[model samples]
Target: MAMTLSTPPVPADWTRHTPFSDPGRHAELLEDVAPSPEAIGPVVRNLLAHYRAEGVNMPVSSRDDINLRWVEEMLSVDQERHPGRSLQDPRATEARLQGCCRDHTLLSVSILRGQGIPARSRVGFADYFVPGWHSDHVVAELHDGERWRRFDPEVAPESGLLPDPWDLEVGPGAPFTTAAEAYRALRAGELDAASYGVAPDHELSGDAFVLTEVFWELAHRYGDELLLWDGWGAIPAPEEEMSEDLLALLDEVAEQLIAADAGDKDAEQALHALYVRDDRLHPGERVLRFSPLGDGPVAVDLRRGEDAVTRPGIP
Candidate 1:
């Protein structure tokens, strides 16, 4: 009779904000930033510019519809491209903000949860850019009050490809992998679900894009910090098909997200009670997205209450 669990909010309660990492009114542009990924990873790689790896040449209508899911609309489009500057200066990689790597991990988890620090965002599958593939990534974990590090604010420690892009080493020949550890290593065939995705000649990728990246790694670990091509609840539409009870409910959600990333508070309260009683695992009020700038599959509408200002495939 061993069953009685309910204590799961710790990790400094992720410092706060998760309507896609808030930062409203630009939260004073992360008030003097510095919760440390060596000062929030080069201010999120100089306020983002990786629309497709560093040598950013801009304009395919400005890096194809960058789905900026609120970090106050990516600091209001980086204050309309460097207006009052100083998100710690140094712009000019095509004046920044084109985004990818999940907008450099949701603006470095919204400046480390606006400096109170807890942080989040994981999604996963990196294998260092693309030699034998495994692309699909998104980093930032934070919580350094004594654990959870795993950074890579879109890799830039002179791109030696992480010996410590601020402490990475995720597991099994490490270089990150958590779409529930690449869906339990592609159901234990031990890897090669079409070499993992979105790059090695991008036609999306295999094992149903690692089962929609394990429902985008539990909707960015329960916070609903979405947009890794945002689809909604129970996420299965790239011509939907996987069913053997949805691959045994994503193999018990990739074994409780790898035992709640190895700390396992009853596997993080059974993955927060199966992501709040599973409405196909969370994300209601509309989702569909898919636009890698082509703006095809829209739907969006996430309520947008408090006088919402626009975030449906951000043109």
Candidate 2:
């Protein structure tokens, strides 16, 4: 007999706040700017007109360009004003007008959660823009009572940036691959790891990037919001060095991520517990900031509370 599976219940506050998704940090950064996740995209669309994306249109003049870890860091202007500001709230980020895809995604997650919506960030590869390649990317997802809906705040129609804005009304036809899907594809050999990251010239590919994202996505669902480079398990190792055992582990990790993406509370708890003891993976009340710049990514530090460690005394 075919049995029916039930979806578990997730708390409304599960995705609410971490130092990573603190919307109050937005208002704390700019009193005039309401830290509304709903309003963040419009603000980003407007802000990008002036603030160039670091490493893309703009050059990394200082670590500030790369070190802006949290969503709020995008708000501050100039290195002299806020150097090494680890996390920038939306208001502050808007003020500065600089950020990468991760910053845009974090801001959206923060704003949405502050509005009392269950939202979280997803790390994966996007195939929507450059047909042949899956670019390393991040996006936001919210539970609309019945099912989880994906939202690419960076590609919102208001920005007119992405060639194809994912239509929430129509459901998930977007260009990005969730960490779970990437893991599955790689494991099945349906997709090669070399084609996984940005362009062929980019460094990532093989199992390392896809598996790292799966691990990252698992942590994000359980509210850890780990930094991009907080490697454990198989993260820092080269793909050629990965073993069969590691591949099997990645398969399990992918399952958990897929479950979390589908809003499985049981899987969420399982992943949380799995990473609970890994000091590097489980920041608990702390957040590790990852800055993807230069040949190797930089690690900021572990921070506690919602306040930006990089910019204290602002509030």
Candidate 3:
């Protein structure tokens, strides 16, 4: 499952951003931290200390969106020192000091790229956390010219929620999963998409939960991290809305994803091309806002390629 296969050279593009992972946007925040390219491990550790998950003691008003840049969220430990920063600016993330899983992963990916290491954040299920359910999560994947390594900078031993323990150099699962894996398993009826969630009572997970994340991860693999509020083509569309064409497309993506993980560069490129070709996944952009738990509707910006444009959280 957690086999370490040798890797080929990642295309240079992975070393930079695809709109979402842009580090240059917040150069000052990442300046001296991981100044050198080889300091990836230290960068991961630094972030783990800097962030606390959204639900843990953090107010709901402060923690909803996953689209934030690293600068503001990372530096919140001392905002008084760094005043007058925009919430969207990456520089402010450092001052804000906390975020959800994607935030941590993005910060790591952004910092790693700043150091010139080919890295990207991946979305999928993390099995090591909750038993029986594969909680939707994200982690950073870095290719150091020789092999691709996965790191989870979010949950550390002190996080208290990590009972199974996480291997920063390897990520979760005996064989960690991506959107493709979840798609194949769902299609095969091996696993229920609704079964995957942060917790059983959480409203975010539903019948189409896994499918939605599949498209999100697909978008990320293709160089963009379709925001948490983003909708991808017909992915989270209603059951009646899922066309035969989309199902066929999912099959193709699943196949390529398997090959991509197996060291097939061609397959990897095809996946990115397919994503770009379907511009449906790259809908313009959604400028939304985040609200806390008790602060009314929270105005959740849920886009399922569907009409309902609100969510309680990342579903």
Model 3, runs deviating above 4 Å = 1-12, 35-56, 59-98, 158-175, 237-241, 285-315
lDDT of each: 0.75, 0.56, 0.55
* Residue lDDT tens for model 2, 1-315: 111222226532543466556644344433333334344566554444222333344434533543455554545443235454432322343334455566667766665555555667778877754667777777777666566666676776655545535433321455777878878877787878877874566666656777667767766666656555554434544445656765676677678767766658788667655655444443433333333444443334545444334321111
Candidate 1 vs candidate 3, lDDT winner: 1
What tens-digit string does per-residue lDDT give for candidate 3 at 1-315?
111333345433666544445554356556455522234334544443233333354344445333344334344432443464432334333324444567667766776666666677778887666667777788777775666667666656565654423334332245347877777778888877666865677766755677666666766665555445444456453344456777787788878877887789898777766766575554433422222223332332333334332211111
User: For this target, which candidate reaches the highest lDDT against the unseen true structure?
Assistant: 1
Model 2 residue-pair collision total: 12
Query: Where is model 2 poorest over a 10-residue stretch in terms of lDDT?
Result: 306-315
The local lDDT score (0 to 100) that residue 92 gets in candidate 1 is 77
> Which ranges of candidate 1 are over 4 A from the true structure?
1-8, 11-13, 16-27, 31-46, 51-93, 97-103, 106-108, 115-118, 125-135, 139-177, 181-187, 190-192, 201-256, 259-264, 268-315
Clashes of each: 1, 12, 24
User: Can you give the TM-score per candidate against the true fold?
Assistant: 0.33, 0.72, 0.71
Off by over 4 Å in 2: 1-8, 23-25, 28-38, 48-63, 76-96, 156-174, 230-234, 277-292, 295-299, 305-315
User: In candidate 1, residue 98 scores what lDDT?
Assistant: 81
Candidate 1 differs from the real structure by a C-alpha RMSD in angstroms, to one decimal, of 19.2
Residue 148 CA error for candidate 3 (Å)? 0.7
